[model samples]
Target: MSYSEAREMFADWGVDTEAALDKLAGIAISVHCWQGDDVRGFETRAGASGGGIQATGNHPGRARTPDELRADLEFAYGMIPGRHRLNLHAFYLDTDETPDRDEIELGHFTPWIDWATAQGIGLDFNPTFFAHPKADDNLTLSHPDQGIRDFWIEHGRRCREIADGMAAAQGGEVVNNIWVPDGSKDNPVDRMGARRRLEASLDAILSPDYPRERVLDAVESKLFGIGVEAMTVGSHEFYLGYAIRKGAALCLDMGHFHPTENVADKLSAVALSVPDILLHVSRPMRWDSDHVILLDDSIRAMAQEVIFAELTDRVRIGLDFFDATISRTAAWVIGVRNMQKALLEALLSPQAQLKQAEAALDFTTRMILTEEIKGLPHAAVWDEFCARQDRPTGLALQSRLEGYQASVASRG
Candidate 1:
């Protein structure tokens, strides 16, 4: 079917295909760099990833160097339909020096800024809170020992410094995200003490004044983790209160919550209180699986709420998943394209009429219309979007991904 016909069909449902396309085009999905190497960073002294995080699979052609990862990302970016941001971990530094986490300097990431500048994209950053020796007993920022806590605080400060540097070079706010694995496997007798230490540590890290335009500091929370099966010091409540009280952005990872819980449903509630929040879009088989995102019902619901609340500017969307089972480039391409597709579908929904129906207490009609709109010609609109972006639509990019895997990824 012609795109014009699909647009007309959508218009009948009070959906603006043009506006949807425009909005989708403007939404920048933050592509994660870890997928290219199964969360392995190109550090001078890289080690195993700890902090209750692990990427499974022995996929060959994993990018083993900074240049190789950049090449893979460049190829992945070409297949994606929009200009997007890249998310980087502190471990991905391109320095010859083996700087400790607290000693990491801006020079370490100068290469990243250069690459981002050339690509015309911005970069988000995260502190490497795990896999370090100082992270003894699965705690860093919240470690009971004062010296240990100080080390992590310095690391956080340095991360903010690097983020600010990147922003100065790239001309946008670099989101400096901090996620820690500070908890106990068994129920802790002194939960309050641990949380108190965590709060103090965070206060210290964020005490220094940095340009808000240059960097936006955020903290992520996890419900539970591998070793910290019983208690997570940085729980949802902890980060939620911290974000609101401290005036920082909170990161909501889709796979971080319980299997039955819907991170999408929490959007409005969080938006109602928090000024701005970041989203770590991912898929979970049962827990925090970090499966690559797809255009699934959960994703659709989240996008719907974002549009419904008119919180596009307030919400920063980013992809946060890594799978070593598939071609890294293909993983990036699929996750990003699916994210865009979900947002596009959300924009194409008959939101105005649905709201009116709900206000009028017409639940039956609302339900019927909701199910019916699912069958809309969204695919046609998406194809037109791909064409407009000068990208191959649908499965047309399959051969390209395969060819890149053989020709490019094989070299890694």
Candidate 2:
């Protein structure tokens, strides 16, 4: 279908316009947009002795009023609803002051848990305590804040304390999505000990204290620069395979693997290694790591080929993307669209033809790709969205999308 016609049909289905664009390309996404300090109202505060509304002397940091926080939560829900989920990354709090356990509970973290419970929105908890850049001399699991061993131990202790406590008190589960940003120079000789340190860290975090059933150690991969930082778990199959052997499942980030990595193959490998697995969906761009864009037509086609080849009911899709300005709600919409498109594309392909081609792979030594020209029924849902793209369809999808993106300083 043409873009405009496809967009029109998508609007009719009640899908957000941006979401339609994302889905057309293929993928499932859960948008990560922080409710920044600005919107939370970090301006002046009531002074001591009731003097007046004066700024705090020491920059008390921005605090979201209950109303503001609630509104943002509602706004996010309205956009993505269910299917797409939200992950509370440590960075989003927008604070350098390490939050105490209680403050962490009170801030967006607690409210988010409460909100998710009420809204039935799935929430993933990321407990990444140590920063990796400082480990320049040697591959260390320790944070600069604490001794290498001490930091690793303390982080696991805290994670267990928080996770166990919440799982018992809260009704829903919390996923301890672990993505350690660690590594050092590319010298294979010096890097020999890095994986061991990483495994040690995971061993502590994934212990019985943490809810293994609910927790997902999403070993995120990063593009390691220089020689100090080793790339994330994305490139190291052995690291992830070991995690599977240790009883903790795998967490795959779509963007972590670059031009050379195949997401479908990664997914299949993880699935075969472990009984249960979780996934993070994002677009990988050659220009950068974590570009957080959609697949576009070509990538989408490739993703479809992958899913058709290896996807199983055991694997679950999560919308994981970083959007600075896009509202949480809009991000959710885009994610859902991407996921639906990916799956639909897979389901609609010529499976029989694909299977036949696979059989011939042994003799022909060529890859077979199944394709179809039929547009999905859901394409019609975008009519209202298309109408509103240039004008107003009584829904401010564009304005809201742009507004959220602007808030995060995200361009395109």
Candidate 3:
């Protein structure tokens, strides 16, 4: 069906397709930089991927240098239809000097800020807490050794400063998220002590003064991972309380939660307490193995939750996954387009009527409406969005990606 027809059909249900498209266009998804290079940043001369993290597949054309990564990112962003943000880890800094995490300064990321200025897109930052020598035992901020903990604390401090610089460079707030793989492979006897140390370390890292308008601080948690299967230092429960108390943004990584737990359900719960939250959208297969996102039920539900809670302003959407099995550019395009499609689906839904049905306890009507709305012409609206944004729609994007891989990526 034509887009106009679909828009008219949606209008019958009190959903303005144009308005939905406009709203979706404004919401920026923070695209992860690690996806282009399989997380192999040139920060440290580090070894293999460790700390309960692994990227499967050895897809060729991985970004080896900063220029290559930036080129690949631009290629990926061209297919995506929105004013999206770029997410960078501290390890992704472009520099000849392999400075330690604590030693990193804004000068190291000056090129990145300059790039962002040229691209006209904002930037996001993350403190790299894994795959470093300090994380040898999977304990960083919560380490028993004061020196190790101090190193990570300093890293966080520098990360915040860099985030402020990025914000100033782009004239937007940089969401600085901290995700540490600090835990024990075997159940430790000092759980309380570790958490106490972590809390104290976080307090110290966040103690430094910075412009609140420039940077937003967030802490991410994990259920468990390869070495830290027995215990994780920053569980969701731990960060929830900490975020509530410290007034920091809580990062809800979809893959970090258990399989049975719906990350969507926690959105409203976290929104009610925290001032704002960061969403790390990634697909997981039985574990926190970061896979590319798709237009699946899980992602759809998460998008619906965002719409239902009216969290367009309170929640910042970010992509988090690296699948090297396919073309890195295709992976980025597919994941981000799927996320945009899901958000479009939620935006085009008959939310007010559904809410009214639920309020009146009209279970039968609500169920019928919910099922009925699924068959609406969301695809038409989505294609229209792509067309409006001047990006290839559907199968057209695939061939473009293949062409890119054949011409640009394969040579790289």
Candidate 4:
């Protein structure tokens, strides 16, 4: 179905039109170096090669021209319904200057930042290759060169600096997200160099050098294999738990775990160990590489929905992916809406009902305390909860799930 048709169908289902609109509006896309229209064969090719192998475009070829790039950003902005901001990755900036430690140099590309500001959206400066494997094993912040170490440390600091400057420039708060694409294969243990580097980076981030309260440093973890190429923070719990011990919060990427890992249980366990949290929402697939699938894929979406259905207000979901097609933008927008629908269904699940039944275990204990409870005025919470439901609600929820299943089948 077309995007508008899907919206209309959801509206017709007694779904609050305004809420659906807002949720769709709340959805934003992250532009990887290759996903836009300006670059030829961009979706397939690795991005422009200048500063590094996976570095941002430079010198303005026909595909990487300034005007074309701007147009692509505008196109992405227009696709998001209203008042929503984009989560920008920093791989697009030309790193020709390689600025000094304390310098406030805005690399070769300022127009992208300017454009995002004008659109009433906040941009995440210093975006990293957190999802890609190359940045994990091949890169390091605390290398021998002072310039590189300074650049890495300065990059973390500058995200806060740019956020303040951007907020002043655009009149709003900007978000700072950080993830190290670093770890070893055989020895997943963080060496002195890795720990010191991560500590230095986090210290710069959490420093009072800028108003630290104004920014958020989301430390994203990854999940990979057992080989030398396998390096991610997801399995390296000690390192991640240590970071949280030293004042950094975890950004739990949904795609970054094995099928056996219960995401809800993981969150509960991690929350006990760590005080703060940020969530990265994506569809998980069973593979060694990152598979950027839509959120409605049942095997992936079910676990996420089950966890989030009972969520309080603390969880914040950020959509992360390297869009491989023009249709990916609209697909993601619809995918988020579909995931919410599944979450609503999951909330109404019989298993959850059973858990609620189990919560009444305390009711028996309270009843044993006093026989006067029977005579006194008391309300039946479970009866009232059951009273609020009917055959229609059940059918409606079942129909929605079946509809989602049918939709996935058709796509396949």
TM-score of each: 0.98, 0.66, 0.98, 0.60
* Backbone clash count for every predicted candidate, in the order shown: 0, 39, 0, 1
Local accuracy by lDDT, each model: 0.89, 0.47, 0.90, 0.45
lDDT leader: 3
Stretches off by above 4 angstroms in model 2 are: 1-30, 33-70, 91-108, 130-146, 186-189, 209-212, 223-235, 295-312, 323-332, 350-353, 356-369, 374-378, 381-396, 399-412
How accurate locally is residue 233 in candidate 3, as Cα lDDT from 0 to 100?
A: 93
Q: lDDT at 268 for candidate 2?
A: 58
* TM-score (C-alpha, index-matched) for candidate 4: 0.60
| Inter-residue clash pairs, candidate 3 | none
Candidate 4, superposed: residue stretches over 4 Å from native: 1-34, 37-70, 76-82, 94-109, 129-137, 142-147, 185-193, 225-239, 272-276, 295-313, 323-355, 361-412
- Model 3 over residues 283-322: C-alpha lDDT tens digits? 9877687889989999999999998889989999999999
Q: Looking at candidate 3, what is the lDDT of residue 363?
A: 89
- Ranking of predictions according to lDDT: 3, 1, 2, 4
Model 4, 280-338: lDDT tens per residue? 55555553222344434442344344344433333444554433332333333444434
State how far residue 140 of model 2 sits from its true place (Å).
5.4
The candidate 2 region of ten consecutive residues with least summed lDDT is 48-57
